[model samples]
Target chain A: MEVNEYNACVREWADALFRFACKCTGQASDAHDVVQNSFEVLWQKRKEVETGKAKAYLFQVAYRKSIDHYRKKVKITFAAPPEETYTPANPDLKKILDRALAQLDDQARALVLLKDYEGYRYEEIAQITDLTETQVKVYLHRARKILKEYLVSVENII
Target chain B: MISWENYEEYMMMHADGELKPAEAQELMAFLDANPTLKSEMALYDLTRLTPDESLTYHDKNSLLKPEPVKRVISFPKWRKYAIAAGIALLVFVSLFKYIDTNKNNARIAKTDTTKPIIPEPANNTSNKNEPQPQQEPKSIAATTVQPAKVTHATHHDIHPQITHNKQLANTKQNDNALVNNITPAAKATTEISSLPITTTKPLPSEIAMASPPMATIPAYEITPPAKPTKRSLIDRLPIDEANKRQLKTIAHITSGASRSVSKVKEEIDGNAITFNIKNNNIHISF
Candidate 1:
């Protein structure tokens, strides 16, 4: 890829990648580290990557690095629910959804974030998660079922 | 055709908004017929995670800035020179080894060296025909060239001179010349004139006949004059440059640093000076 094209990739996708990493890792610092490392890896391998495919390549590297980062953080902190849900002028439904998202596994939450947050296709999510399309569909269906049940429970409580 | 019974995949695709335009029309028509499923499918969108602008980093300019490309591996500067030095040392060592082995091979091939040949006893009865002058080197060469002497390596040195001396001996000036000429075998010998000749009783003629008579005599007199009657007083001696400087320094010291001729001469007349010059010792008695 040309230098300008690669630099454009960095400008265009840096925020999207940071959002994905931030949503996956749930920490500003860890997400920052993941995005930085992913972009650094992309820069190192920029010559081999095409300009059009740089986003996918960056996501692939970020997905792997974020997964590793999540695993390291997982070991130190058992999967506890978030201490407090930071709600900012969001409706109760959005708050409930945020709480439900915090309840999902790192992989499931990342898959959901990639799907709804980034609108990645099932195949792209499958590539990022190292899963078959069928498995991605199955797991995403399960994650949606869980979130639906949580939403239903919050509605009944209200 | 697009009902949930036959193609639930199409329904799920429709829920994800993955349907193409024609499939979207069919899915909308089917969803219009089944009004309950439309609201049910809307739940997928309601549960979908929104792109929270708060979550998306805005100051990602720091990240968006281009880092220097790191594809090239930079080796330490010393590594290039070290590799070059290693190759040069390898070549130099190989060259040295090659030359060393060849030198050993050459040494083995050419083992010949020049060794002085000595003559044998002069005072033999059957050697009455032996010329007294040629006795030293001739007897030595004859003995060495005899069947007992395995060292014929110097035979080249003996051959040319032997041929020349044999022709001279063949000239036969007188009986003295005849006696010398009779020992034609002596002409083939090296000149061993520096060695003092020793006389012993002659062996039988049988042994004398077995030896060659050639000898190359050096031009110096075969015998030295008798030893000096007594030591004589020496007047002066010539020395090399270093000793000459030392003499000047001694003369200057004794001449009250003037180094004047008469004063140094007076200093020299008072002392007996002994010195060695050109391997000869001289003693001056004042």
Candidate 2:
């Protein structure tokens, strides 16, 4: 793909990618960086990539970048992971949800996001997360069960 | 009939729309029968909506913020290509130089093993039966080739006439003339005359078979009368020039050899030269 065509696609997907990255990372600044860098990385490998799959490619790059950020942050601090984000504006519910989500592991949290928020099918989630289709289904089922259990307990606590 | 124990899977899959048509119908029937289960499913569905709203808020805020200054993704293509080419050229030139030097060394070694052949002058006699001079041409050539010997001959105390005459006679006279004139009777007479005197250095025994027969004329004698030798102005200039040229050639050879060795050593340290003893071949490259 040409640079202009790539830039056009970047322009097209930038907001959606930012939204997905924001959902994944929960930090506006980090989400913007993730979106920009994903597009930039896509542009670098633009010759080998197809224009039709560019959006999906951008999301994949953003996903990996967000995960890398989480891993790096985890190493430096033992605080709550970024994905289980709670904001001050909706402190009560946000705290409950954050507590619930944090109870699940990294892959479980990612699986929940990819499946529930992104509406990805087990097969698509498998492809995106580099898991087998069976593993995706199993992981998503287990993650949902864990979230459901946490949410029930959180409702009781709140 | 889905059990209550797996009821959450039914609710989640129903929410996800992953349940097959028949399975969805069964799940729907089950939820219709259980109002509490339907309410629980609704609450889980509510929790799912919150993340999306947060995501939209964050996304809008990010989009509202001014886009980042586009970072110039510098490729450095030219510098990369130039560096690659330079390394390739260095490796190529070093390898060629090494091979050429090795070939030259091999040739020199081969030449060193073979003895050099030197041609001796044959006797040209005016008499019917004249004896031949037996001189080893190889030794004569080796000794004659030494410039130091020529300088010594000119330096030592001796008859200047005799030495001058001797050098000339050696050049112009054949072996037969040298053999005849160097005999004691002929030499004494020749010395008395203003005529040039020639001397014959005795041949080594190995060369005696080829030497002229001992004439009753006393085979060899012509000692130059001792006198303080005058250093001639004529010989010095030519000898100095010859010495200078020899030194320059030696210096050139040494410098060339040293440069070649240094280039080879550089290639070795750089790991550019690979010798494959199994294949009996060498490959030098980047």
Candidate 3:
């Protein structure tokens, strides 16, 4: 891609890449680092990437960097009380969804973010996440099922 | 086509927005037929996450690149030619100056080598009463012959001779005034006849008889200065007039002789003299 086209990619997709990275890494600072690194990699490989494919290339690099970041961090125990014991007092849908998203693993969360937030097709998501189309579909489905189960819980719905 | 066994797959595809419109309609129809399963579709729909439009990479300006700069310099045709001509002129002048200097140095060396050595005249204070040899007259006659040894005397040799003649003239006037009162003409004639004629040229008898001699007539007044000493055509000129003639002679040997003389004169004058020889103009200032 030309320098102007790469800059256009920065203007157009930086936020979406950041959002995806934020959802994957669960930390705003790590997500910002991932976004910065992704764009840096895109600029380095601009000669090889087409202008149209810059967004996908950015997401791919962001996905790998986010995965690396996820691997390096000490695993946090996301232990929740039993579904019956939880209170359903929180009505903020965005907060509830964020809590629900935090329940999923890094790869599955990135798949969900790439699908729902960016609205990439299964094939495109597979290209970004480096998975087969069938695997992307299966993972996304499983992630969606988890989110549905969380939302459907009586404590979460109220 | 949408049965209970395959209903979940259609619902998942519907939530992911990957299902065809006809398949989605069929799944909705199957969901409506089973109201309990319609609640499951609501939960699937809720799984979709709306992006937070506010979240953005704030420092995106850092990623942008600027256009590369190009610099070029060009000169006009006339300016190029003018520069070339200036360089050519400077080189020509420098070469001419160098050749002129070398020629002047060589000419100065030649002139130095050929310079005549002026010998001191013989001692004048010998006994006058004692009979001297007939071949040699006294002091003045001996001094006259010394000029013959310097065959190539230049015009510079004349200054000392002129000064010597003036001194001799003064001495002769003083001696003649004193002696003319006391000595008679017949006594002076006897003394003149007694003096030896050393010169190769015979004295004219009529002139000797016609002349009224004093007790001491300077020998130069008697002999006519040894026929003025034979000299080269260049050396015959007076010193002031010979500069141009000498320059011309050196010019025949080296082309830049006149210019070299001018340069030498300028150095001697310490730039106090300005002599310019230009086309159709000669400028001189002091």
Provide the RMSD of all predictions against the true structure, rounded to 1 decimal: 25.2, 27.9, 27.7
lDDT by residue for model 3 (A41-106), tens: 988999999898888888899999988998887894433323433343644566667778889998
- Tens-digit lDDT track for model 2 on B103-190? 9999999876763443222222221243334334443323333332333222111222222346634544453366366779865654
Candidate 2 Cα errors over 4 Å, as ranges: A75-99, B50-286
State the displacement of the C-alpha of residue A54, model 3, in Å, after optimal TM-score superposition. Answer: 0.4
Top candidate when judged by TM-score against the true structure: 3
Q: Candidate 3: where is the Cα deviation over 4 Å?
A: A77-91, A154-157, B69-286
lDDT of each: 0.63, 0.60, 0.70
lDDT of 3 by residue, B154-267 (tens): 211222223335674465566456546655885565345333342221112312332344224454355434566676666655666669587667757685777778685765
Docking quality tier of candidate 1? acceptable
Assess each model's interface with DockQ, reporting 2 decimals per model: 0.27, 0.12, 0.52
TM-score of chain A of each: 0.86, 0.74, 0.87
Comparing 1 and 2 on TM-score, the stronger one: 1
Better of 1 and 2 by DockQ: 1
Query: Top DockQ: which candidate number?
Result: 3
Residues A80-129, candidate 2: write the lDDT tens digits.
43443234454465555555665666566667776765677888877777
Write one digit per residue (lDDT tens) for candidate 1, span B97-207: 999999998886665332232344321222346444423433333322332232322322222222334553343234234435645556434223222132121233422
Q: Estimate how well candidate 3 is docked, as a DockQ score.
A: 0.52
